[model samples]
Target: MATVIHPTAIVEPGAQLGADCEIMAYAVVTKHCVLGDRVAVHPFAVIGGDPQYLKFDRASATGVTVGAGTVLREHVTINRSIYPGKATAIGENCFFMSGSHAAHDCEVGNHVVLANAALLAGHVGVGDHTFFGGGAAVHQFCRIGESVMVAGHASITRDVPHFTMVAERDDVIGFNAVGLRRRGFARAAIAELKTAFHEVYFTPGNIRDVAAARRAAGAFDSAEAKRFLDFFAGGKRGFARARRAEAEAGE
Candidate 1:
């Protein structure tokens, strides 16, 4: 399996290419950039450009690396690390759709999908199997946990927890039920998670205090419950409160 580089592509010296990798027309793979086996760079995709960090000096510019089987769509821009001589990485099997941008030092995990126009700010960390819908934007330094689904056009400024479905302005309405089911969570486990959600967000008590108490009491007794609690607890910008109708109905 020979690597394929389009005639118009510019792959700089010292940029390593793996077997079966494809660099399309007009794409640029800059110095020290490494593309793993079967990686696909679509036309106009830009990889390994210098960091956009204001504090970074040209002499200390770092590089970018893409892992095996990843696909970078047309016009996608992935920048290098801000720290001198370091590398920013995109994990294996991930998909970056057209026009998406990953800023300097961002860490994207394996199997994650970034939809068209989704943007990840510098130093953001996106966990494996997460999906960022079209036009979603993550703030700098935020952490998005594994298997989460961020709804289209949502603006995320805070950390999003694993296995959650967040939508409509910081509202974590529920667990990622479809994702959980696909990942083999049993019916009992799902039911327990639902109960935890009710208690944490829908009940009459103060959300933070109630969540803390539930955590202390070990209520629900599952890894999902703990993860949910931990996410809410660690929130610097607090989670959204349940809707008025939902809160009233839960009473």
Candidate 2:
């Protein structure tokens, strides 16, 4: 299929668009941008805009790359990286709702969904199959694990673990059981994840010590459990935890 660019849209010279791309009215695909096959840029969306950094050079040769089958809705803005040869990357089959923003140097993974007005700060790394609720905001340099669900209006300043569901208050409520089910995770795997979740997040001892002990004991039975344990090892901003008061209330 041929690429389609509306007469009203401005695709700057040096932008590389693959087959079947659709650029709608008033959308801008700036120079150095690369859009893969079937990518859609809706009206008023802006791709490959300059980085919003004080130290960024205007002459930098950085760019943005959107993988195949992604959709950027109306009013969405995705900024390019700051340094030469770098890029702000969005993976295949992702969806960015209207008004969503991906700041400079973000690494978004495949099948991720960013709802309307969701914002990702510079250098954020989001894993595959994650869901960001409407108005959710992730702080710079944060890492969000795969299959996680962030509730609407949440402010995420730390790393979120895989298969978790975070509430609006930045608390990890529990595993994303429904998402796991929908994704066809085996029942036994889900059960193992549940047990590991309780041990890592809700154990009585010092959280770090408990996690270490569990790791040392070879207590994790599944690959998913091991992955969960590995996540805590590199938590620079720490991990999101259950709010004790809130959990008590819910119980």
Candidate 3:
């Protein structure tokens, strides 16, 4: 299938668009962008714009790469990276809703969804299959884990572990059990994850230390549980902590 660009849309010289991409009216794909097959840029969306850094060089040769089957809805903005030869990358089949923004050098993974007005700050790393609720905002350099659910308008300033649901300002409320079930995770795997989650979050110790000790002990058998424990290895920002009172309230 051929790529389609509305007459009013601007695909600047040197922009590379793959087959079946549809750039809607007034959308802009700058020369710094490389859009993959079947990517859709809705009306007024902007891709591959310059990084928002104040001290940045305007002549930098950075880029933005949108993976295949991604969709950028109206007014969504994806900025190019600041470092030369680097890119603000979005993985395959991701969706950025209207007014969502991905700042420069973000590494967004496959099947992620950023709801309307959600904002990802520069250098943030998002794992695959995550969902950010509308108006949610993540601080720069935070690493959000896969299959996590961030509630609407939440302010996240730290790393979020896999399979968790966060809400109300950096609170890891509970496991995203419903999401795990929908994703076809085995019941046994889910059970292991739940156990690991309790040990890592509810334990009476430092978050990283608890996770490391549990991982070192070979306590968890399932890969999912290990992955959850392994996420505590290294990060600049601390991991989001579970709010025990809130967690128990729902139980």
TM-score of 3: 0.98
Best by TM-score: 3
Candidate 3, residues 1-251, lDDT tens digits: the string is 68999999999999999999999999999999999999999999999998899999989999999999999999999999999989999999999999999999999999999999999999999999999999999999999999999999999999999999999888998888889999999999999998898899999989999999999999989999999999999798998988887765532
Better of 2 and 3 by TM-score: 3
Task: Name the regions of candidate 3 deviating beyond 4 angstroms.
Answer: 248-251
Task: Report, for all candidates in order, the number of backbone clashes.
Answer: 0, 0, 0
Error of 2 at 35 (Å): 1.1
RMSD of 1: 3.1
Poorest stretch of ten by lDDT in candidate 3: 242-251
User: Which 10 successive residues of model 2 have the least lDDT summed?
Assistant: 242-251
Error of 1 at 221 (Å): 3.8
Q: Against the hidden reference, what TM-scores do the models get? A: 0.86, 0.94, 0.98
- Candidate 2 residue spans exceeding 4 A from truth: 205-209, 244-251
Write one digit per residue (lDDT tens) for candidate 1, span 66-92: 999999999999999988768888999
Q: Write the per-residue lDDT of candidate 2 for residues 74-99, one digit (tens) a residue.
A: 99999999979999999999999999
